[model samples]
Target: MFRFFIIAAEIIILIIVLRSSFVQYLFEDIQNSVSDWLVSVATLPEREELRSLKDKINIRLSPLKPYQQNYVEQITADSASVKRFYHTYCENDDINPNFTGTKRAQLCLIIKQSPVMQVAKRD
Candidate 1:
Protein backbone atom coordinates (compact mmCIF):
# COMPACT_ATOMS: atom_id res chain seq x y z
CA MET A 1 0.00 0.00 0.00
CA PHE A 2 2.82 2.42 0.90
CA ARG A 3 4.74 1.56 -2.35
CA PHE A 4 1.63 2.34 -4.42
CA PHE A 5 1.31 5.77 -2.82
CA ILE A 6 5.01 6.49 -3.48
CA ILE A 7 4.67 5.46 -7.18
CA ALA A 8 1.53 7.59 -7.62
CA ALA A 9 3.22 10.62 -6.03
CA GLU A 10 6.24 10.18 -8.35
CA ILE A 11 3.99 9.99 -11.38
CA ILE A 12 2.17 13.15 -10.37
CA ILE A 13 5.45 14.98 -9.85
CA LEU A 14 6.64 13.82 -13.27
CA ILE A 15 3.49 15.19 -14.94
CA ILE A 16 3.96 18.56 -13.29
CA VAL A 17 7.65 18.70 -14.31
CA LEU A 18 6.77 17.88 -17.90
CA ARG A 19 4.33 20.79 -17.99
CA SER A 20 6.97 23.32 -16.83
CA SER A 21 8.50 25.74 -19.36
CA PHE A 22 12.08 24.82 -18.34
CA VAL A 23 11.51 21.15 -19.01
CA GLN A 24 9.84 21.87 -22.35
CA TYR A 25 12.70 24.10 -23.45
CA LEU A 26 15.27 21.53 -22.33
CA PHE A 27 13.50 18.80 -24.35
CA GLU A 28 13.45 21.01 -27.47
CA ASP A 29 17.12 21.87 -27.12
CA ILE A 30 18.07 18.20 -26.72
CA GLN A 31 15.96 17.26 -29.76
CA ASN A 32 17.58 19.91 -31.96
CA SER A 33 21.07 18.92 -30.82
CA VAL A 34 20.39 15.25 -31.60
CA SER A 35 18.94 16.15 -35.03
CA ASP A 36 22.02 18.23 -35.92
CA TRP A 37 24.40 15.52 -34.72
CA LEU A 38 22.64 12.86 -36.78
CA VAL A 39 22.76 15.02 -39.93
CA SER A 40 26.47 15.66 -39.54
CA VAL A 41 27.09 11.94 -39.02
CA ALA A 42 25.07 10.97 -42.09
CA THR A 43 26.60 13.58 -44.42
CA LEU A 44 29.76 12.56 -46.19
CA PRO A 45 32.91 14.55 -45.44
CA GLU A 46 34.51 16.68 -48.19
CA ARG A 47 37.39 15.05 -50.08
CA GLU A 48 40.84 16.27 -49.04
CA GLU A 49 41.90 17.08 -52.62
CA LEU A 50 38.78 19.13 -53.23
CA ARG A 51 39.19 20.86 -49.91
CA SER A 52 42.78 21.75 -50.75
CA LEU A 53 41.77 23.00 -54.17
CA LYS A 54 39.04 25.17 -52.69
CA ASP A 55 41.48 26.50 -50.10
CA LYS A 56 43.98 27.38 -52.82
CA ILE A 57 41.30 29.12 -54.86
CA ASN A 58 40.12 31.01 -51.78
CA ILE A 59 43.62 32.28 -51.18
CA ARG A 60 43.99 33.38 -54.79
CA LEU A 61 40.61 35.10 -54.72
CA SER A 62 41.12 36.78 -51.36
CA PRO A 63 41.68 40.14 -53.03
CA LEU A 64 38.39 39.99 -54.93
CA LYS A 65 35.18 41.53 -53.59
CA PRO A 66 32.34 39.22 -52.58
CA TYR A 67 30.36 39.72 -55.80
CA GLN A 68 33.43 39.24 -57.98
CA GLN A 69 34.29 36.04 -56.12
CA ASN A 70 30.73 34.88 -56.80
CA TYR A 71 31.33 35.50 -60.50
CA VAL A 72 34.43 33.32 -60.45
CA GLU A 73 32.61 30.57 -58.57
CA GLN A 74 29.74 30.70 -61.06
CA ILE A 75 32.06 30.49 -64.04
CA THR A 76 33.74 27.39 -62.59
CA ALA A 77 30.38 25.85 -61.75
CA ASP A 78 28.93 26.34 -65.27
CA SER A 79 31.01 27.91 -68.02
CA ALA A 80 28.06 27.59 -70.40
CA SER A 81 26.04 30.12 -68.38
CA VAL A 82 28.49 32.85 -69.42
CA LYS A 83 28.06 32.03 -73.09
CA ARG A 84 24.27 31.98 -72.80
CA PHE A 85 24.26 35.25 -70.90
CA TYR A 86 26.67 36.77 -73.42
CA HIS A 87 24.53 35.79 -76.38
CA THR A 88 21.40 36.95 -74.62
CA TYR A 89 22.82 40.31 -73.53
CA CYS A 90 25.64 41.06 -75.95
CA GLU A 91 23.07 42.18 -78.54
CA ASN A 92 21.91 44.94 -76.19
CA ASP A 93 24.47 46.00 -73.55
CA ASP A 94 21.79 47.86 -71.59
CA ILE A 95 19.87 44.63 -70.95
CA ASN A 96 22.49 43.24 -68.58
CA PRO A 97 24.86 45.97 -67.41
CA ASN A 98 26.27 44.15 -64.43
CA PHE A 99 29.22 42.10 -65.70
CA THR A 100 30.94 43.65 -68.70
CA GLY A 101 32.63 41.53 -71.38
CA THR A 102 36.13 42.37 -70.14
CA LYS A 103 35.27 41.48 -66.53
CA ARG A 104 33.71 38.18 -67.57
CA ALA A 105 36.79 37.36 -69.63
CA GLN A 106 39.02 38.06 -66.64
CA LEU A 107 36.95 35.82 -64.40
CA CYS A 108 37.05 33.03 -66.99
CA LEU A 109 40.79 33.26 -67.18
CA ILE A 110 41.11 33.05 -63.36
CA ILE A 111 38.78 30.04 -63.30
CA LYS A 112 40.78 28.36 -66.04
CA GLN A 113 43.96 28.86 -64.01
CA SER A 114 42.44 27.50 -60.79
CA PRO A 115 43.59 24.07 -59.61
CA VAL A 116 39.98 23.13 -58.91
CA MET A 117 39.07 23.42 -62.61
CA GLN A 118 42.20 21.53 -63.65
CA VAL A 119 41.35 18.65 -61.31
CA ALA A 120 37.77 18.63 -62.55
CA LYS A 121 39.02 18.30 -66.14
CA ARG A 122 41.03 15.15 -65.27
CA ASP A 123 37.84 13.33 -64.30
Candidate 2:
Protein backbone atom coordinates (compact mmCIF):
# COMPACT_ATOMS: atom_id res chain seq x y z
CA MET A 1 0.00 0.00 0.00
CA PHE A 2 1.04 3.61 -0.56
CA ARG A 3 0.94 4.31 3.16
CA PHE A 4 3.41 1.43 3.87
CA PHE A 5 5.71 2.64 1.09
CA ILE A 6 5.72 6.18 2.54
CA ILE A 7 6.53 4.88 6.08
CA ALA A 8 9.31 2.60 4.80
CA ALA A 9 10.81 5.39 2.67
CA GLU A 10 10.76 7.75 5.67
CA ILE A 11 12.47 5.18 7.88
CA ILE A 12 15.14 4.52 5.22
CA ILE A 13 15.75 8.26 4.85
CA LEU A 14 16.02 8.61 8.65
CA ILE A 15 18.59 5.80 8.76
CA ILE A 16 20.59 7.40 5.96
CA VAL A 17 20.45 10.76 7.70
CA LEU A 18 21.66 9.20 10.95
CA ARG A 19 24.63 7.69 9.08
CA SER A 20 25.74 11.16 7.93
CA SER A 21 28.81 12.90 9.48
CA PHE A 22 26.81 15.30 11.64
CA VAL A 23 24.91 12.45 13.34
CA GLN A 24 28.19 10.53 13.75
CA TYR A 25 29.68 13.60 15.45
CA LEU A 26 26.67 13.82 17.79
CA PHE A 27 27.02 10.09 18.63
CA GLU A 28 30.78 10.50 19.30
CA ASP A 29 30.13 13.50 21.55
CA ILE A 30 27.57 11.54 23.56
CA GLN A 31 30.02 8.60 23.85
CA ASN A 32 32.78 10.89 25.12
CA SER A 33 30.45 12.41 27.73
CA VAL A 34 29.42 8.97 28.99
CA SER A 35 33.03 7.73 29.17
CA ASP A 36 34.07 10.86 31.08
CA TRP A 37 31.28 10.25 33.60
CA LEU A 38 32.43 6.62 34.03
CA VAL A 39 36.02 7.73 34.53
CA SER A 40 34.96 10.12 37.28
CA VAL A 41 32.90 7.42 38.98
CA ALA A 42 35.67 4.79 38.70
CA THR A 43 38.40 7.01 40.16
CA LEU A 44 39.49 6.05 43.69
CA PRO A 45 38.90 8.61 46.42
CA GLU A 46 41.98 10.79 47.05
CA ARG A 47 44.21 9.01 49.55
CA GLU A 48 43.52 10.20 53.10
CA GLU A 49 46.26 12.67 54.20
CA LEU A 50 49.00 11.16 52.03
CA ARG A 51 49.86 7.99 54.02
CA SER A 52 50.13 6.85 57.63
CA LEU A 53 53.54 6.33 59.29
CA LYS A 54 53.17 2.53 59.11
CA ASP A 55 52.80 2.75 55.34
CA LYS A 56 55.90 5.01 55.34
CA ILE A 57 58.09 2.24 56.75
CA ASN A 58 59.71 0.20 53.96
CA ILE A 59 59.22 -3.56 54.41
CA ARG A 60 62.82 -4.23 53.28
CA LEU A 61 65.18 -4.93 56.17
CA SER A 62 68.81 -5.44 55.10
CA PRO A 63 69.96 -1.81 54.66
CA LEU A 64 68.76 -0.70 58.10
CA LYS A 65 70.66 -1.02 61.37
CA PRO A 66 69.54 -3.93 63.58
CA TYR A 67 67.37 -1.65 65.72
CA GLN A 68 65.75 -0.11 62.68
CA GLN A 69 65.32 -3.56 61.17
CA ASN A 70 63.65 -4.76 64.37
CA TYR A 71 61.30 -1.77 64.32
CA VAL A 72 60.56 -2.21 60.62
CA GLU A 73 59.91 -5.90 61.13
CA GLN A 74 57.50 -5.15 63.97
CA ILE A 75 55.63 -2.60 61.86
CA THR A 76 55.68 -4.89 58.84
CA ALA A 77 54.39 -7.75 60.94
CA ASP A 78 51.48 -5.60 62.15
CA SER A 79 50.66 -4.48 58.58
CA ALA A 80 50.97 -8.06 57.38
CA SER A 81 48.46 -9.09 60.04
CA VAL A 82 46.08 -6.39 58.77
CA LYS A 83 46.48 -7.76 55.27
CA ARG A 84 45.78 -11.26 56.59
CA PHE A 85 42.63 -10.07 58.38
CA TYR A 86 41.17 -8.60 55.19
CA HIS A 87 42.25 -11.59 53.12
CA THR A 88 40.61 -13.97 55.59
CA TYR A 89 37.36 -12.04 56.03
CA CYS A 90 36.92 -11.11 52.34
CA GLU A 91 38.08 -14.55 51.12
CA ASN A 92 39.58 -12.94 48.05
CA ASP A 93 42.96 -14.26 46.99
CA ASP A 94 43.22 -11.52 44.40
CA ILE A 95 42.85 -8.83 47.07
CA ASN A 96 46.01 -10.00 48.90
CA PRO A 97 48.16 -13.06 49.24
CA ASN A 98 49.45 -15.17 52.13
CA PHE A 99 52.00 -12.74 53.55
CA THR A 100 55.11 -14.71 54.40
CA GLY A 101 58.09 -12.71 55.76
CA THR A 102 59.85 -12.92 52.37
CA LYS A 103 60.63 -9.93 50.14
CA ARG A 104 58.30 -11.43 47.51
CA ALA A 105 55.35 -11.12 49.89
CA GLN A 106 55.94 -7.37 50.21
CA LEU A 107 56.27 -6.95 46.45
CA CYS A 108 53.12 -8.96 45.82
CA LEU A 109 51.00 -6.19 47.31
CA ILE A 110 52.47 -3.65 44.84
CA ILE A 111 52.53 -5.76 41.69
CA LYS A 112 50.02 -7.68 39.61
CA GLN A 113 50.49 -11.42 40.05
CA SER A 114 47.58 -12.60 37.92
CA PRO A 115 48.31 -15.40 35.44
CA VAL A 116 47.41 -12.95 32.64
CA MET A 117 50.82 -11.29 33.14
CA GLN A 118 52.53 -14.63 32.59
CA VAL A 119 50.62 -15.11 29.33
CA ALA A 120 51.59 -11.63 28.19
CA LYS A 121 55.25 -12.35 28.99
CA ARG A 122 55.14 -15.58 26.96
CA ASP A 123 53.92 -13.71 23.89
Q: What is the alpha-carbon lDDT of model 1 when measured against the actual structure?
A: 0.57
- The TM-score of predicted model 1 comes to 0.44
Per residue, candidate 2 scores C-alpha lDDT tens digits across 1-123 of: 999999999999999999999999999999999999887666422112112323443433234456654544443343344345335423354432223345434434432232322333466
- Compare the candidates by lDDT and give the number of the best one: 1
**Model 1 residue 117 CA deviation in Å:** 12
lDDT of 1 by residue, 1-123 (tens): 999999999999999999999999999999999999987665423234334534555575456668756654553344344344434544334443445566545434554564544545676
lDDT of each: 0.57, 0.48
